[model samples]
Target: MIAIVSAPTNLGLRPPQPGAVPGTAKAPEALREAGLHARLLGEGATDAGAILPGRYVDHPNRSRNAVRNHEAIVDHARRLAARLVTLTREGRAPLVLGGDCSLLIAAGLASRVARPSGLVHVDGHTDFRHPSNSPEIGALAGEDLAAAVGLHLPEIADIDGLGPYFDRAATAHIGCRRDDEHLDELADTIGLVLPADRVVMHGAARAAADVLELPALDRGFWLQIDVDVMDPQYMPAVDSPDVGGLSPDELIRLLGLLAPRAWGASVTVFDPDLDPTGRHARTIAEIVATGLRDLGRDLAL
Candidate 1:
């Protein structure tokens, strides 16, 4: 069965202004308001409620090596990881609704405790900023993938001494646009990579087929979907919306093809503040309802 767990955290992101909290912390509730929970419940999904986060404090003057809300994010990640371990132990596939991509830390942590796991990262940007590549790193959201692969600081990357939750050979990254500055670095790091243009050219089914062939699928994988993968024309509500991205139908079809095999999945980086009309919420809800309807159903083991 699919279990919907809300990790309503925006601590991974930098505040929009000097003193404002990111609106992404409200994403889980906003998606619920748009009928995602109702629709999924009717489809046999269970509600796992939410894991709350600490208050977002703007710290512009903090050292570059220090992540914003560092202690709070670590505490939240540990708690979130414990819950995920419990849910997976009960044989439920988790659908984590996120406030930002930093939730991947918890997911990676939990997956390590449950079993050997792989990662399938689908995002518009490579999200590879790390201490090795950039000195401007602090926000965990943008640097999540780097941390997940054990390329960041020891504290964030090696929580509980379980660093590098997903192996590079067992990781698949898809949907980054051509112009992403980190593309070259990512191409050298991740095992399987298919950029947006590649996906669009070959079609979703073919893309799915390629990913399914990865060695990672032999052990099952965690799927991370950042809604910003959709073109800004379709989904501009994320913290960073890039042009030349996928269409909504393409992303939905890709998810429908991929979710069944994933042990768990997360949907992140959709900021509600930019979407004043709530139309984006309804659209994302439908994507979750249709695309992930079969989540946790086809784990390798």
Candidate 2:
């Protein structure tokens, strides 16, 4: 069984950010329509924050604000952590649907309660910049990957027991682009860096295969697919769209390939509101639905 958690909070971000559409987290609904029994963290009807925080840049990018979002980040993380642990203990996969990229923290920490896990990052931006060098030092979403991997502000890094939740050497970030110069440094620190070229030339299938070919490949896998990995023309509602990205066909193929190996796969398509035509939403829904279906065959948690 798969338990779905919807985090409809964009509060973990700095300004000039794009997040999952407000009142339009149709991903889980689509998943249910496709015959999956999914549940939102707080409520299934609409966006709510108990376990989820609303969108805002309450935390400073670094030292630029009053108080960092320490309390809020920890509070949210703590709640999600408990829920995720419960799911893991029950031997179920949590298909986390998010309001922003910051939700990665929950997924990372929760995976720790069970067997150690590896990550498959599929996105345009590396999502691994520090507050200091970030284009906008006022956002949590941007700093999320760093925080998960034992970086970022003290609160996030010192998350009580979850500090080492992120094993940098176990994570594989694929589909990184040149625009994300900030991420290049962080990616190098992790394990192997799979550039956009590899994702483009080889497709996510070949690239993911190559990633699994590495030493950490056999570990329990957690997949992160940022929708910006799709072209803007086809996926206009992304927080940041790289000029060169993988096609829908490529994405579907990659998901099909990865589904067989996912212990828990959580995807975030930030800035879904920026999608003007809802063309991107439909596209996202279709592809994700197909991917989950494939996973149903053997998707363990």
Q: Find the candidate with the highest TM-score and give its number.
A: 1
Model 2, 1-301: lDDT tens digits are 4566766555555445243223324444443443334222222222222356533444324466322355666677777777777776766666666666667777777767665777777777787766656444445666777777776766675576667666888877877776677656866678767777777886667786777776775765777777777777676666666777778888888887886677666667545456544555567666765664434235454
RMSD of 2: 4.8
**In model 2, what is the error at residue 279, expressed in angstroms?**
2.5
151-214: candidate 1 lDDT, tens digit per residue: 9988999998999888888888999999988999998998888899998898999998999898
Overall lDDT per candidate, in order of appearance: 0.90, 0.64
Off by over 4 Å in 1: none
Tell me each candidate's TM-score.
Answer: 0.98, 0.82
- Report the Cα RMSD per candidate: 1.0, 4.8
What's the lDDT for residue 11 in model 1?
Answer: 94
Q: What TM-score would you give candidate 2 relative to the actual structure?
A: 0.82
How many clashes in each candidate? Answer: 0, 11
